[model samples]
Target: MSDETMRWAPAVPAANHPGGALRRWASGWWSVVHLVLHPLALALHVTALVLLVTGTALVPVLGIGFLLLVPARLLVAAGAHLERYRLAAVLGVHVPASGPCPVTGAWWRQLVLDPRPWRRAGHLALVSTFGVIGAGVVLALAGTGLAALAAPAVSAGLGHAGEYSWPFGIPGTLHAPALLVAAAGVLLLALTPPVARAFTAVEVLTARALLGPGRGEREAVLRRRVETLTETRSRTVDSVEAERRRIERDLHDGPQQRLVSLAMQLGMAKRALDRGGPDAAREFLDAASSSASAAISDMRHVARGIHPPVLTDRGLDAAVSALAAASPVPVDVEVLLPAGGRPSPTAEAIAYFCVSEALTNTAKHARASRAVVQLWHEAAPGAGLLRLRVSDDGVGGAAPAGGSVADGGSGLRGLGDRLAAVDGWLHLDSPPGGPTVLEAAVPWTVGGDR
Candidate 1:
């Protein structure tokens, strides 16, 4: 799909919304609220660290060392999680969760070896110290401004002759301009939000540096991503092989066998003709013709299952409709693709496959008499997205969430693997004793290689 179609899709960056500037400006001061707990959080973290060290030092003395070590470890882990959550809650900055240690052994051993939580625990030192400074600065700017702004009103209430009162009844040697002080107050007040925002930005950067993945962790993440991609690719290839084998089996059992019989009949017809048995030849020819036509029709059916010409020419609406038409159970199809909004071939094929597989699963396991299929194109981040949905009313819970084919449900695990190959995703909802719904979404950019 072309980029023009992207305007019709779901979700955009939240920063693009109207009143974004005002929202951003207001959000700057939110971190100041987080500073309220900084000192207490710092104290708890310190206590945990001190106990952890003490436990480690006592390890050689006896196994009694674990008494302090276990609680300390729990405290550190819980504190890190809470800290990360606070950043997200106060400033909308999310720190990625740390992965568990790969080493095998006791849980405490894993905790002791894993450095991520410790790194986060160390960040509390900065959060407490720098956070205190930030709080002081904010209070000075905002408090000073508000107190100064209120000065003029307070001064008007005080008696002043040679001893002139300053803003709040304070005796002043020199009587400064009331207007000037109020103007300074307005200036400081104006700076408060931006200054708060700057500190928030710094704190966010610090948190990300300490609490987010480090260099080794990033390399591990990249390695895992590669492994996942390789796994998905293998699954996709396996699925393709399975489908190919199914097609070959069907052809061998159906059209191929029919063609073989038709060939024998033609030979018999020729033998009858050569022997001057005209009546026998006619009967053989008629049988051969019938077999030929049946074989041709079977071939067409197999070809349609592979890749239909109608799909290539007419898009998903007509193609999926054809699938619904051929089903044993009635299927409701709703496809609302615009005339010019044809998705990329990749998207169409994946969508077609999803719809086909979902329907098959529903028919085989759902025990339902009816099903529904819906397909549409929507705008996405980089390109258009094709959305496929299949729902059936039958004995549900055939495939509970996360249930795989091994669980005697739909083979959606394979579908998920296939979708992942294209940066796409699949979702299935099959609750026991009722309706089953399957949803898949494929983006046109990477999926289509656009």
Candidate 2:
């Protein structure tokens, strides 16, 4: 589909208006229960942080302080992780995990330089305070409501009307104080959900802001993407140029020469006919016919090299099946695409080429007796991806650019570049002397008719 037609629109949540007493009461009770646990969880978080900080300080003096620090930071991170899940569960707000931690450099250097750890620590500290306050407020509201609800029972048991007072000097009543207190209790209970929601929102927002991917990590991701794109762009340009040269060479050596010969034979036949030599003209015409057929066959082969007609006509499934059928060795093909679900033309073409190239490499170099090609669509929230896996039981010492395959040219690397053009990637797993698996994934969304 066109980008304009597939523009994204934000989804707004429908507001809940309590339509029944039962719903209000249940919501209030749920708030009271969760609010009671919120404080406990926060208290635990605070205690863990305190211990973590203290342990780090003491261990540093003992020369093992750095070792303790790493685990301490991890503990802090673990607590923050749990809090993120808790926020999602209790508050219905999802906070995704922070991006991967940098593990390449010295552990101490990475930990010290990375800001996420410190941000998580800060969140732990603040959540403790927020949790305490929320717990206190919820408990006070629930406790007061419960106390008011029990006033009538207490008064009846004592055989005398109990005195009850409302907030802000609303005045206590000895006569029918039970009714007044119960009414107050019901009011308090009704207000608890909104009040608890307000308090919980603070913690949820804090976790989302502090416990998720920070600005630094996001920028780092973008920078890496830029580098990848630059490399892929260069490779794509080189690949296109190499392909053009290849096609030129094919035409020069194959179809173009054949057509030239065919024209020469036709000229010779015309001359023989002019000389009234029927037998010589007939021989020349026969040769010319053979040359023309060879030329047509050579042109068809070149065209197939550019793009297989089957791929355009029948989609990825049929294209891949044709590839498997043509392989020198046995190939097992499995294609799992949903009915009525088709990837964009570009995606399908890329997938077909990747499989074709990989299978060619397998058949030519792997010396394997058999191979397998699997294709499937993976669906996600906003988009889908086409996943292809080609594996062969061949002598597995293949690298993208070097090794034995170096003589075979940079076909694998070119495939990677092709996939990268579509925001896809290629992964190669070829160990010393065993199976070699090539997997590629490309983003694809259902588009307008083929």
Candidate 3:
């Protein structure tokens, strides 16, 4: 699995193991004695697990009981609070203190009102039950060790009383069985932390599910999203302005000045027409008119290329229609939109030009039979969500650098930069051998202050 998949995998605690060779040897033999003690430890774990699961699962049932014991609700509430804290420590969960569950009139009524209180209550009750089991196991292990110390004396005919040689009337002459039991008890105590941590993890998960944050937190998240989108909008405007300046410079120096010189020559030719004969004047006039017309046409095309009038007046669907008609290849378009859901003018312009550029690339390079264009107002799961996309189908392996922007000589790099300025993104997916798709998404509301 990929890293993302692994990141969301569930937690599993590791089992405790001996740290060194002496400990390992002790543990190997300890296991033999532990067999005598395993049942008790196992019983503790099983009992605790069952209680924890049952109490949490039957929260609803206990909620009903709270209604009848309204007076003792404090005690019940206290017990739940302790369990929550203890569970946090045992399970090693780092959860915020939610404080006590509020007191409601009639314990049973309160329990019925909220399932969580009872669920937590149930878990606490189970923890208490498991606490008993764990204590019993410890006691059993201790008892076995104490009895083993006395066994030697009892076997020697001194009786159990004669074995009392140390503090608390306990014997310290370690025998095989007694030593083994003591070692096993130490191991069990050491393993408790891991067992507790597992339970704590479960509690953390349960609390997260049951006591999720309120509406205010959700609104705060939404606000952050808006803030991020606003920042994107500002960047988009800056990028667009930069692009405009670049295009203006390109035209002013290259086409615009050339057109101006062409107009001057045409004017001179017109003056010469007055002095020359009718035939010569006619040819000069024709050439002058041709040059003037060519320059005028070039300027007009440039102005239209800068920002198409169709896009401003007709919106994305209509503008894309105009582009489709102009494309060299047959293009099919499908658009579904609300009647009044017009994208902001800038977004519409960007989208129209983007589709225009993409389709132009497809027609010029992708050796495909047909192309499809789709436009729509799509909303994601949250509020304030609106987006548009354009896609195409043609020969695969088309990329901005390889075909569209590079070979076609359009500043598509500027187009991508413009989209980015608005917090929008452009995606191109094409693999060699036959179908290429391009997509772009931008916010509906204007991104920047422009």
What RMSD value applies to candidate 2? 7.7
Worst 10 residues of 1 by lDDT: 402-411
Off by over 4 Å in 1: 1-23, 37-43, 57-65, 102-111, 157-164, 167-176, 234-353, 369-414, 424-450
Q: Give the TM-score of candidate 3.
A: 0.45
Question: Taking the tens digit of each residue's C-alpha lDDT, what string does model 1 give over 144-236?
Answer: 999788776666657553344654666653246567678989988878888877777787887888878887778899998899899888988
Error of 3 at 358 (Å): 1.1
- TM for every model, in the order presented, reads 0.62, 0.66, 0.45
Query: How do these models rank on TM-score, best leading?
Result: 2, 1, 3
Q: Residues 1-450, candidate 2, lDDT per residue (tens digit)?
A: 654344444333434544565565455455555557766676557766775677556654764666666776877878887888776566556787789865568876665556677778888887777766777887788788988898777756775455544457665665667677789998886777778877766766777789988877778989999998898889889888888998999999999999999999999999999997888799999999999999999999899888889877777888898889999989999999987667888788788888888899898888898999999988643467889999999997776422332223477767777777668878887776858888888887533334
Clashing pairs counted in every model: 6, 4, 17
**Candidate 2 Cα lDDT to native:** 0.77
